[model samples]
Target chain A: MSTIEDVTREFEQIIPSDTAAGQSVQERIIQMLEELRFEDRDVFGIRLAMEEALVNAIKHGNQMDPTKTVRIACQIGQQRVRIEIEDQGSGFHPEDLPDPTADENLERPCGRGIMLMRAFMTSITFNPTGNCVVMTKDRSEPEPETPAGESA
Target chain B: MSQGNRRLDLEEVNGVTVARFTDKKILDESNIQIIGNQLFSLVDDDHRQKVVLDFTNVEYLSSAALGKLITMDKKVKAAGAKLRLCSIRSDIKEVFKITRLDKLFNIFDNRDKALEGF
Candidate 1:
């Protein structure tokens, strides 16, 4: 695995408060990850986490205000790859989010961001401003032990 | 979405309705919501049991789109139908792999391979 010191790449992009903007940010993130020598898996998680972050920022934070801005910053370091997404809106507390896996809300379309973030990233945190999210994914780890003939 | 070409192709088999979406990478909540509606209208109870989504032209996908898939799957399964996929490209496959969605959905190498058991 290439350590952060081996290749530390950075990316910064600002997109309009629109869905298409999210795609551009995702593409930029993948390009930056590639420059850091990350393959598909790393890029996938980062893209997923970052997309959720941006969506929440645009939809929830800024309330889809076209005039507002969503800022994204990424840094690849030795320990992990970190991404921060900030919105100009009043932020919501990460702790306050309801669980999407709950039976009562299983059918809901919205509320899965936190779940996916936790499931895919090493850590998902929020800043005090309530409008910023910091998500991290550790460098790839060895595969989990799988019994012979057992599918992971 | 652009109507630039075909993003989805519709088929009905054994009373199941299938709409294969291709080359879709950056779909949002609005378009996905619309697709959801279109999917509901396309698949009737008679054809719900054997629907397939072909990703032959798709190379990448977003988690939001994945959310849409799960929601769609639930609806299809409720109607006693199944939603399966085939011909998923490698780049998009990695998204499914990393997100552990590979285990959540039935994926095949090609359209014929996916529709074989059904």
Candidate 2:
């Protein structure tokens, strides 16, 4: 059986604080996941979580400053994918964010991105300074095989 | 609107306006801004009483897109107009569910259902 270190592929890059730049990085990571034959559902969740995290890094953390940069590190394996995103700006407290799901905040336009990142990722963490976030998603188990005669 | 500039395909069905999203991935900020403006115009400019946002062609969207939808819903409600969302893929639907937006907006499985009672 392959361990995390045995099967994992590691990558790292630093990108400009531009949405387009972030998108290119996202596309690269997605292609890697597809190449590994990750399930569609897992891919979908990871893609969503990554988008939110990168947007937060580029737009919110770095404040879209052209001079600032976002660093991304990723590890992809047969059993899981892990990503770490860090920005140049000072981080804010995650607890201070208003709950988008609350009745009073439902109509609010923002604040849902972080919630979504947590929901889609199997595990999510923010550095104490709040400038970086790390997320991971475990590969879903395949559906059990049925007997040849069963309709299923 | 210029053909290339259009982000939604608007059709009037029995006095209800159905606007289908043209893009498959509504993730980018500029694109979401354009879509939001078009959606708000349905009420602010056209003054349409009943609107349905059809998502059959949309396969992926981000929180920025959701923010636009929330703003659209507010405009629709403030104008005393009604808005409904339909044909959202399961993955996208889960996003709404996670944000508790499924309860905020009137959602249906298809356009026909969304247009009902309009």
Per-model TM-score of chain A alone?
Answer: 0.82, 0.90
Residue B32 miss distance in model 1 (angstroms): 2.9
- TM per candidate: 0.73, 0.93
Candidate 2's displacement at residue B51, Å, is 0.6
Listed per candidate, the RMSD to the true structure in angstroms reads 5.6, 3.1
Q: Which ten residues in a row have the lowest lDDT in candidate 1 chain B?
A: B39-48
Residue lDDT tens for model 1, B14-101: 6545567744554566666665555665444334567788887665556667777777777777787677888887767766665556
**Poorest lDDT segment (10 consecutive residues) of candidate 1 chain A:** A1-10
Docking category for candidate 2? high
Instruction: Quote the positional error of residue B58 for candidate 2 in Å.
Output: 1.0
lDDT of 2 by residue, A1-152 (tens): 12244455788999999988888888999999899888777888988888899999989999999999999999888888889999999998999998888899988899899998899888888899999988988898766778899975
Q: How close is candidate 1 to the true structure, as a TM-score?
A: 0.73
Candidate 1, residues A1-152, lDDT tens digits: the string is 22245436777778778877887777776776677666556666677777777888888888999999998877777558878888899887778878665656555556767677776788877887788888888867545668999874
List fnat, each candidate: 0.20, 0.82
Model 2 residue B17 CA deviation (Å) reads 0.6
